[model samples]
Target: MTEKTAETKVTEAQRAALGLAQLSEDERRRGLLSIADAIDEHHEEILEANERDVTAGEELLAAGEYSQALVDRLKLSASKLDSISEMVRSVAHQDDPLEKTLAARRLDEGLDLYKVAVPIGVVGTVFESRPDALVQIAALCLKSGNAVILKGGSEASHSNRVLYELIREATAELPDGWAQLVEAREDVDALLEMDDSIDLLMPRGSSEFVRYIQNNTSIPVLGHTEGICHVYVDEAADLEMASDVAYDAKVQYPAVCNAVETLLVHEDVAEEFLPEIAARYEQAGVELRGDDATREIVEEAEAATEDDWSTEYGDLVLSIKVVDSLEAALDHITTYGSKHTESIVTDDDERASRFMRSLDSASVFHNASTRFSDGYRFGLGAEVGISTGKIHARGPVGLEGLTTYKYHLEGDGHVVASYAGDDVKPYLHEELEAEWTPGDRSDE
Candidate 1:
């Protein structure tokens, strides 16, 4: 048997992704819709595969090899599969993200320039547990006219493989191997080294795992390392509303990345709000760790350590703190936050505005739970991931984030020499309204 090298597999996948990129926007959209339909039609098959993975995961959990949170993330219910299908349909309904003219300028007579959106070529994503992510990534990549290589965690290997097979079959007519799946753990190292072939890398997992991927890969990564999200209850906040928001942020879905792991209460409200929220947390079986001031109010709260402020405890655990003022809260967030999500509960508009503006996280909120910082809830149809990085995309990365732009210059025998020397033609740098029409090539 010929030994297949990692480089060989990546090269093959990249070639397929590039081929998919050549598809027209309309074709890409159709392909996405087709995949969605296929998912709906084959839901049972996917569920069957998911059950196998879940059963295996339960055994691992019983053996103490996996956390309950990992088991929760790995399980795929029928509703989740349905939601995944709907998300694919939503991506198809969105406006085509390719070839949109972002800017147009008339350089000179018969010479025009255009900045247009285009696909980012090949995208490589390594995600954990959630097999549904495989569908989301493939749909978003197809809609944006990019090829994708997905590597999901081994725990969900069966489910991921089934979903990948469905997506590949649906997209088979468009471009050969438009979606590729790599399941081997060793392939991750190989994929990271293929920077020349992969344009972007998105790793979704633990902080340490994301860091490991970033350290090993030369490919540009677009993901947050951790989500140490927080919700601050301002002194002027309505105590009832603040308590409700804080509770929802932590208790609604404690295992996800967007869940709030820290709660900051103002000194004025700490005496009243801490005990109330603590009672609520206790009802939900959430363990509360607090600072000195917070511990004084909630006697049951264990004393929080410095490390508690920075940890992303993706479980039913929360760290609480009491600050003298909003500024103190902001300082604490600045020092310990992962720049993922932060929320403030305040009735005062000025203070709310200030908090929203001053916080430097990717998604900042006022009078809302940190849980609202989601791609689907934000209405990007679906998100590839939440990006904390500042360069390409900042918040929920949808189809727009999956794309880059190209400069398209059009001219009829126009030369730069005409505008260079003395007595040269005057260059006209006038803005013009332009749209990309089919068959409009730069060479034209």
Candidate 2:
């Protein structure tokens, strides 16, 4: 008789995260090495699985289930594969933020207070078709001493599972169940409800998906809701610089998160700048949605709508609006932006300075493309994701984003009662910037 008993399942999200967060620096380094080892050992398997996903992805796109860009990004090549492995190695080589002592103070003669970095514990990532995100996220979480649980898109499910297998095989040398992935039903709810096992959820797909995760789960969610990035051409903007930056921001990689979705040009330079940028978009086959003012200015542009302003057109679609001044652009972004990346092109020193200081996005740029608002360009070895939420990490979540702090007080049993005494007083303090710059701030 072929009879079977009930099968049980377990989510390592919480357990892995808690374990990774509590790991010593040396253990964390070992985790990073394990990911690198996995990628190196399973290259052929990962490549084969990617090929199958590509075939299925093509059929899905043919049926209008996936986009061309998404499919293409999901295809993994040798160089990209090697890069992911190198990234894990690099992450292991970087400084361990969780080991840093952020602050220290004296409560009494023998007692001291300490603020040190600690992991946020288990991090759950829900991303789209990019298979490399699995490796990158795993590398970052391990090196930062946080465990990660990934839930990729349906189109890449097979590929994701295969990749997870590879990672697990590589890390088999580590403590049992130290590294893990979520392979539950795509029911979305089951994935979201693994909150019982997950400490945090990072959705790196569309605004809708991220919101879904945030709405359903009590777990902390990381990643931007949208990347309606903008590039403002100032009145005194250098035409060449503005054109190049705008083109690169829009056309360089139109399908990714960092690409520009909106173009704001000061009326003073609208005629000159608009024609140049519009022509580039035209050549790239990018659809242009222009405001009435922009429509009056550009003949071939289509009429814009309220929805266009708030949309994250992860394609060759861009929204164009004319602003009276730099202030207008900043205000518009503040109103409609997901607070991702915003750039101002100008030769005016005052306007540039003010724009940089005024905008409230994760990355504010001057005389550059919004594309530069990335992990690698910003010199971070790798990034888990670009986050918009204000609570934990606000911008690109690099090594520093993975860490929260813990106070380690030494000095012969320090007691708060001493500071409460008549003559004793508590220490003064200041809030630290969430910015995770890699180097020391120069005194200059």
Best by lDDT: 1
Clash numbers, per candidate: 0, 3
Per-residue lDDT of 124-213 in model 2, one digit per residue for the tens?
Answer: 777888888887887787777776666677778777888787777766655445456555445456656666666677888778878777
TM-scores of the models, in the given order?
0.95, 0.87
Model 1 global lDDT (CA atoms, 0 to 1): 0.87
Enumerate residue pairs that collide in model 1. none
How good is model 1 by TM-score? 0.95
Which 10 consecutive positions of candidate 1 have the poorest summed lDDT? 435-444
Q: Write the per-residue lDDT of candidate 1 for residues 1-444, one digit (tens) a residue.
A: 965566665677678777776777778888888888888898789889989999999999999999888888888887887898889988888888888999988787678888999899888999998887888888888888887888899999999988888887887788776677887889999898888898999999877888998888889999756789999999999999999999999999888888999999999988888888899999999999999998888999999999999998889999999999989999999999989999999999999998889988999998899888887888888888888889899888998999999988877787778888887888788888767554343423
Error of 2 at 304 (Å): 2.3
Per-residue error (Å), model 2, residue 370: 0.8
Candidate whose TM-score is highest: 1
